[model samples]
Target: MDKYTKIIEQIKALEADMVDFKIVDFYGRLRHVTIPTTNITDKKLQFGFGFDGSNFGFAETGKSDFVARPVIKDFVELDPCLEDPTATFMCDVYEAAQDVKPYESDPRGILRKACNYMQSLGVADMATWGPELEFYLFNDLLVRTDPQAMSAEIISDEGYWGSQDDDYSFATRLPKKGGYHSVPPNDTQYQTRVEAVRRLTSLGYDVKYHHHEVGGPGQCEVEFNLMDSMVAADCIILGKYIIRNTAQEFGSYASFLPKPIFGEAGNGLHVHFLMKGKNGELVFHDPNGYMGLSKMALSFLAGILTHAPAITAITNPSTNSYKRLVRGYEAPCNCCYGMANRNAAVRIPAYATQPEEKRFEYRVGDATFNPYLALASILMAGLDGVKKSLDPEGKFGPLEKMDKGWEPPVSIPASLKEALEALQKDHQFLLDGGVFTKGMLEKFISDKMQDHLRIERTPHPVEFEMYELI
Candidate 1:
């Protein structure tokens, strides 16, 4: 039998009761349709499946039809979270029009187009990225919001919020804001985090490690090894899926919100990544250069700095994201680079001295981001810098100028609306190579504006605290 036939036979052997065809919407939520094993066949596979795009925050009701074509290599035996004996695959969406092209609103397709643009520029065979995924596990959550009532509360098992009230002798609670790499007894989510990592490993992800982060309130981090741009994005999507579900299995809810707590630490998805040159050699490395970062890499970084204001719309996309990126938190808000400086938006890790190990950490983004748009926009920015020969030396980066009172090239937008406004003005780089079309950008901006307005219209209960006295 052919490759397709072999795949069908393999699925039949597994006796899968159902298969789920999944894809990510523009906002990064996984959307899927389940099909029973009996309905899975060659004819159905070749013709693709139909779905309503309007419901997915894509098209209008008039043009809602879209096609979902399965990516065969993404097929895997799913965790029994869904129906029993089930399989799932990630899919690419196609417009229902006559041309049958990939949908412009599809973030995955956008990333593919970005990769193609990079290859066309002859800068590198491919780019690579690794994300340090950080999140929170809340043991209890309560929210009451409406015209009638508004309130919120969260509790973490490892948090010292009310440890004195807990009578259990085995309770493991850390001090206020001091949960960094805490050992098993001190880290309440230790087994749950390990189980999540194990699930990822079983699914073929190269999970680096897992630990309690510095939130001191059940904040956790799981790091993964570097992979190619597209695969890395996929891994992020998949990794988040496994981690969240595993947390739920242990009776905790996983949240990727950048600042879930008021005064405690927040989550940031710091990326440590490198690119490969045309010859497949590491492009960021240069023995003669400072911090082993080649001149090309500096230029690429300059591109990122140039576009940092706009890229924030994609990286830190939420209104609450601004709460985590404020000063006094060491969450890089400056558009500059430095050697191992936690305060710098882009920092070259001092520990990575080997030629092959040369890579920079972008500390601005968080898990609230859509991995596809986040990485694609970042790659496009770097490519623009390289193409324009933008310099990150004294003019753009290199740590010393900040002390000399040299203003950084740019600053991060303080609000989601501000970031979207920057994106609206500086999205020409994103428009290059037709990766992101005008219509897509327009829709994204319009949809995100609603989020900003929603928060604006809501009345925070905190107003009552001060105003009631007046």
Candidate 2:
């Protein structure tokens, strides 16, 4: 009769032995709980199973109890990854109190609230996002972090390293930065990517295309069609899951690390977004506007550029993220926008000529981001820009005109600490509509600061190579 009852009935039809409940943790990793299907009832589906929130880094030990309530809409009767017939559902975390409430820091919940907030305003009833998920597929990956030995070895059958070994080498080993859209033989991960995309298609995703990326070491990309904000974020989370699982099945490893290989194009989760007005009109397109972007679109672009450093504190929170953001890798190093300019933080895609297709891409993010937080932060900042009518024309760019000696007003933060510090000073926008609370921001900053310090104190393998002679 009810949605949960309907979901239970559907699961029963599948005759699944177990129900797999999956949730995204603070760091964007998937955490799961399994229960026999016999125990699944409507009440269980409604109330959800309990878990320790502190273990997810969401609360202290004293206040760690939380509920992982499954979303009825996310129920999947057949999962392609699992060999067994197990029903799977994605979950949203909530407080396990007498008066149950949505967890404020829950990444998914935060994005949901942001979407609702956007709709509450008269400007837009819905926001759609198209995200490009890029990652590396490795044939072999090894890492040692011991005090006596610290090193990482990444072996890609399609890379030049494969050429050194006659036994393992393929005839078409890819040279550094040479794998973009490469065909078979050179693109050794082709079947793996195709299989991953097939699984995604089975899971109801509209994949645009997938191909080898510029990093000849097996870097690949999978682009998905535009969907609602929350759905887009969920797609990224589960997309990575299916990809990683599928890679393992093929005896390979899929890594979303921003800069897994030095001197190569890095992985980026470039997002393109456009809002729909109350009348269902595209809010970002204008034929008379600069490069066919409406005033509201420019304002949105300004918001992202203005708050990019702060947003990067969440989107590119890892230390290795900076390694990819540096110059010469096409990663944005400046807070600016340009028509089809890959070097700017935001770029209006050259091919998006139609009203529905017109949208600006945020180029400064990576797969290391928690999709929910990363996307929500960008939306909040853009909404704030809309509220203020922030114009980026003179301040940020149409950088193509820089042949006359133009200088950027802002530079992207060069380190994680700098980005976090920017977040500390410029986070009032994130607090709009109660999407993000001060406490949540504080926790995120403190936790990331600890991570940065830990990495700083550790000795890197490159350190030995550089300082051993001294």
Q: Please identify model 2 stretches exceeding 4 Å from their true place.
A: 163-169
Candidate 1 clash figure, as a count: 0
Clash statistics: count for each candidate = 0, 0
Candidate 1: C-alpha RMSD after superposition: 2.0
Q: Please, what are the lDDT tens digits per residue for candidate 2 over residues 1-470?
A: 88888888888888888999999998888899999989999899988989998889889999899999988784554677998888988899999899998998999999999999988877688988888999999987898989889878887778777633455656667878998999988888899999999988887888999999998889899998888888899899999999999999999999999998888889999988888887779888899998888999899889889998899998898998999999898899999889999999999888988887888889999888899999999999999999999998988888886655676777889999999999999999999889999999999999999989989999888887899999
Candidate 2 collision pairs: none
Winning candidate number (lDDT): 2
For model 1, which pairs clash?
A: none
The number of the candidate with the highest TM-score is 2
lDDT of 1 at 169: 32
Residue 184 alpha-carbon offset, candidate 2, angstroms: 0.4
